[model samples]
Target: MMEFRSVQGSLIEAEAARNRARETRMRRALQRILTAAEGVPGYAPMNWSDVAEVAREALDADRPAGSNR
Candidate 1:
């Protein structure tokens, strides 16, 4: 037999964790993008929106097909 228990915390905690993980992944992706960009000829400066778009694409590409996340 097994027992399940709940710890007291805001329901928002799970969402906060997910957001933190996503931010970490985005940061890593941004670092990789910047590193790769450094080697490109005539590389242009990247704005936050551009970086965000690329990061979102990278994150989406990492997800398995048919996943809602």
Candidate 2:
């Protein structure tokens, strides 16, 4: 239900738009990493809960209140 218009400008413009979106995404990721490194607290410090549990318990040592461990 559409028409095919093979104008060269349209293709170039589309490529440019895609590149802009990619750059915006990259910039956002960089900003988030910087903020979390600065300890803004918006980011969770741990990843992969199951994998980190051993390390967490080793470092924390103290069990949280009412923990069933």
Candidate 3:
């Protein structure tokens, strides 16, 4: 029951708020996964930086030499 120009705020502001909520949900789910993984048998914890570096190395190994990007 309102005119288009009478809307709450800019479209971008609404979209950004929506995106922030989605990211919060995603972070919660990811944290739950990590917590559960920590309790699994034979699970070992490492620094996130170490994990990230290892993941990057694995990706690099998967790629062919001289391949751009």
Candidate 4:
């Protein structure tokens, strides 16, 4: 019915927003890695997983243990 259609539309919109946010994150992460490697010697390009892993490690290191989010 109409209610079902509304729900489906809302779900689609939410998914689109989520996709956009993910794309933005990926772009920003790539920019960070590229900027970091710009002047370094023997710099090699990395895949998304590699950059994400590096980012995650940095974030973890910055946070104090047993700290609540």
Q: How high is each candidate's TM-score?
A: 0.48, 0.52, 0.44, 0.59
Which candidate leads in lDDT? 4
The parts of candidate 3 lying over 4 Å away from their true place are 1-9, 40-69
Tens-digit lDDT track of model 4 for 1-69 = 999999999999998997786666666666768865674556666667877786775455435698764
Instruction: List ranges where model 1 is wrong by over 4 Å.
Output: 1-10, 40-57, 61-69
- Expressed as tens digits, the lDDT of each residue in 1-69 for candidate 1 is 122223334446776887788788788887767865675656566677777777788689557699996
Instruction: Give me the overall lDDT of model 4.
Output: 0.71
User: How many residue pairs clash in each candidate at the backbone level?
Assistant: 0, 0, 0, 0
Q: Over all chains combined, what TM-score does candidate 3 have?
A: 0.44
- What residue pairs are clashing in model 1? none
Q: Tens-digit lDDT track for model 3 on 1-69? A: 465655655676887887786666556545545765587655555567755654455445435699865
Among these predicted structures, which one has the highest TM-score? 4
Better of 1 and 4 by lDDT: 4
Candidate 2 vs. true structure, TM-score: 0.52
- In candidate 4 the C-alpha lDDT for residue 20 amounts to 82
C-alpha RMSD between model 3 and the true structure: 9.4
